[model samples]
Target: AFTVDVKSVANKQIPCHPEQKMLDAFLRRGEWIPNSCNQGTCGTCKVKVLSGTVAHPPTPDSVLSYQEQEEGFVLTCQSVPTSDVVIAVPAADKPSSTGHLLRDMTATVLQMQTTATDTLTISVGIDEPLEFSAGQYVELAIPGTNDVRQYSMANPPSQSNVLEFHIRRQPGGLATDAWIFDSLTAGDAINLTGPWGDFVYDDDDDETGMILLAGGTGLAPLKSIALHALTVNPQREIHLYHGVRRSADLYDVEFWESLARNYSGVRYVPCVSREHWSGRTGYVGDAMLADFDSCRNYSGYLCGPPAMVDAGVKAFKRKRMSARRIRREKYTPAP
Candidate 1:
């Protein structure tokens, strides 16, 4: 047991212990941390380890580089303090009421469609309707594998009865490889958890244009928010950049194109990193930077692999975008 002294962005001090995970300890004491992937990949749970000796579990090198490890930065989800410590975390402006509403949900698979070789668009209907904002994710329990995984919903709150998820079958992922590829069928029941995440769009800020950045299945939550935005306010200008390695990997291309065609204010840009055929080559962030000259005035929302999200954030920062104007959900694979 060690003393963990947590400091908020405003420098407020909160006392905690090392016995519990940092996030659980903070939440138990009426504090909160922004998070999505509880794994070390999403940089969302990153905090400045002002002073402490923390023991980190062995993680993939791709998650955090040596430079980041050299700095006092640490992912709260993957670090355990060895002694008394002080750390700084982002301030919680409006702590979620949904935090108290966290509970387990048992849902039945309503439908499933293979959109790509390893990607599936699954729709699960909960036994009890859930009230969740866009950009939130639910943990699903794989029946036979006994492995639970988190996936973001691609359907918005307006689509109440159905929760849509874009699931990619990871090569060796225990849960996905087993359930998604082999066992999962329509009508199969799976357990789920609370709609977790704080990266949802600020619906009150209607004047701020939205810049959505997505990679691979990271398009899930962003699609939800985009659909919601179109449904509630069709006049809002939205620039969506979806990136993939190949053109074939670009799932739901026609859907997004149709949305853009239907909504005059919505602009959809597809970016491919490969050099094979001709469309748009290079990084997705570069594509956005090349096309949009007024990124500084736009509010950015990013959901994707940590690399893409980090790159997009850095690009926006270079364009004079403030930290307050960006919301991100880092999708890190579990190691």
Candidate 2:
């Protein structure tokens, strides 16, 4: 065992087992580091190691670059302590959460349906109701294995007991092909660990407008955020964009279209990237660029594959939007 010292508002130390990742060790002790895509792909769980050593895999050049690794930066999700370590946590030390923290619970599958798109919508009822912010995700533990797959909740915080998830069927995916799409069925009990992630919508921000950009099924968290935003922040303008290969890949068109029609400040645009369409036909970032001359007045929220998120960020910055006003969640495929 190694003692991991976490520093932010105050310095606190906890014991970390050699086999355990730093994130699992710290979160177990109620230390929530702002993180998304815990697979070491998004770099959101990165923390500077001020002292000592940790064993971590070589993350992609895009995430923890060689320069960052040389600067003692490590993804807490992938780092395993080899010696007592002191880490600099940038965010304030939060004591778990104000609401219900995460726990291992048995969840029973309630419903599963195929939508207009290739995605699958799964609704499961948990043994206990967990209070979570919109845009947070849950990990589904594979039976008889240590592996778990993460999926963002499609439901808002209001639906605490009945957790909903939108999953894009990956044919070769272990969780999807071998388990979820193949063998999983309604009434089947599965182990769940959640409500995790920090990619939540900031309803309290003074920004009068916000932009939501999503690719494929990356709309999961954004859907939750949109529902929460419309419910709580009625006055703010919400411009949502969902980018897919073709119109066939787009789901929930009616629901989003209805929201735009009913809510005066809401605007939803579904963009197609791979096809030549009469409507918006381009990459998600390009679609955003075409509609808005400048993004300086709005807060931007992007969720998608890393490439899509990167493109959106570049577009927003080029449009005079400050980098601080832009937030993103990257859905990394399970490796």
Tell me how far the alpha carbon of residue 263 in candidate 1 is from the true structure, in angstroms, after superposition: 1.3
User: Global lDDT for candidate 1?
Assistant: 0.78
1-335, model 2: which lDDT tens digit per residue? 99999876365897899988898787666667767677777787889999999998888889988998889899999999999999997664232232336577899999998875658889999867877878888899978778999998889888888988888877787888888888999999999887778788775554558899999889989998888887876666999999999888888888899989889989989999889876688888998898899888888889998899999999999999987778788887875
Q: Per-residue lDDT tens digits of candidate 1, residues 171-287?
A: 887777755778889998889876766778667656778889999999999999888777778888899999988888889988999998999989988888985656787777898
Candidate 1: residue 202 Cα off by (Å) = 2.1
TM-score of 1: 0.77
Q: What is model 2's C-alpha RMSD?
A: 3.0
The TM-scores, one per candidate, come to 0.77, 0.87
Cα TM-score of candidate 2:
0.87
